[model samples]
Target: MKFPAPLVRLWHRLGSPRWFFETTAPWLPWLLGLGVALLGAGAFWGLALAPADYLQGNSFRIIYVHVPSAILAQSCYMLMGSCGVVLLVWRMKLADMVLEAAAPIGASFTALALATGAVWGKPTWGTWWAWDARVTSMLILLFLYLGIMGLRQALQRPEAAGRACAILAIVGLVNIPIIKYSVDWWLTLHQPSTFKLTEKPAMPPSMWIPLLLSVLGFYALFIWSVLQSTRVVVLERERRTQWVQNFVAAEGSKA
Candidate 1:
């Protein structure tokens, strides 16, 4: 099927590593600065200004970090899975680079979620860890990330490695839904979602507002990290190309 002219043009441009690198060059600093500012502002508002929960009190404040990390972790995986589809079906090289760039970021966020969950759990659940469905599924998501990274390292061929990693990312997508609905699907100690699209948040405006800022910050940072990483990957992979050599020479001359 033929796509609209603009969309097709955009797709072709997006697929070009050189185009992507130059296009995103000016975006990196802006994204990083915005992310840092939003995060810092949100952290202060949540920790110092937002009213403490009557029940969990100060402990509930951890949601500022935990919730955003958990949300971003899943979102990152879903992105990787989409990239996997693009790589496998269209053989888009940038999609593979994005998938590889996202893996470690997703893994790090997943680990942060697990760590903060444990910290939140210790006081609330009286345990550091549990076999709760949501928790276990999240752990599996982290493993899937590690597995992709390991698979990439194990393969000597870049094409082979990208293909293998793409397949794994696509397959591991099953765990995302499982993580999302695990609390409702089975008996577990984990609480239901704090925010839902169909319902008002369980939190008041004071709480949810700061949380929202933090979530936005996390997303901004995710984009910044992916773009920056992809840029480096583009340079490394295209080092033999004229553009990359020119870029390097320009930088060297500036220095």
Candidate 2:
């Protein structure tokens, strides 16, 4: 079967590691700048400018951090799962690098979500931790991330490790929906999401706008971190190649 021209072009473009590196290199600075700017703006606006929650008061400021971290954690897992699929089906090396690069970032965000959730819980729930369905599921998600990272590290051959990690990542996708819907699916201390696509937001625009910005900023940060890490992976993986040798030599001469 013949694929469409555009689809074939896109497939080849994305599958090429050198092309991916060259194309993304120029955008990294811009991505970092945008991420930092939006995050700084959102932090100031949400933590100081936005009105306090009627009941939660200043403690509610934690949402700015907690919500974004949790959202990114889940989204990152989805990205990893998609990359795993591409690696397994298309045998794309770039997909493997992406999957590996995303693991630690996803894990970090998951850890942040748990930490901030615990901190937020202290004042709201009068406890540091609880086995609420959402919380427990999120913890499981973190473990899944760690498991993938461990699996990758354990294998000596790159191809074997990539395949193993890809399978693990694809399988772990089952937990994402559980984490997302756990609040609705079970009796839990965690409240429902503040932002919903189908209805008006739970909070006023003044509050939700900054939150929206925070989410965007966090997403940008995730992309930037992944790109930076992927570049390192590319360099290491391609170190024996002529292009990498020339690139290293150029950098050395500049230094």
Model 2: per-residue Cα lDDT over 1-255, one tens digit each: 999999999899987778888889999999999999998899999999999987778998888889999999999999999999999999999999999899999999999999999988888777788766667778888999999999999998989999999999888886567555764466434554442212424899889899998999999999999999998898888899888899899999999
CA deviation > 4 Å runs, candidate 1 = 178-201
Q: Candidate 2: count the clashes.
A: 0
lDDT of 1 at 216: 92
lDDT of each: 0.87, 0.87
Candidate 1 vs. truth: CA RMSD? 3.5
Model 1 agreement with the true structure over 63-158: per-residue lDDT tens digits = 899999999998999999999999999999999989878889999999999999988887766778876666777887888889999999999888
TM-score of the candidate numbered 1?
0.90
- lDDT, candidate 1, residue 242? 98
User: Which stretch of 10 consecutive residues in model 1 shows the poorest summed lDDT?
Assistant: 192-201
Minimum summed lDDT over a 10-residue window in model 2 is located at: 192-201
Global local distance difference test of model 2: 0.87
Q: Model 2: how far is 2 from its true place, Å? A: 7.4
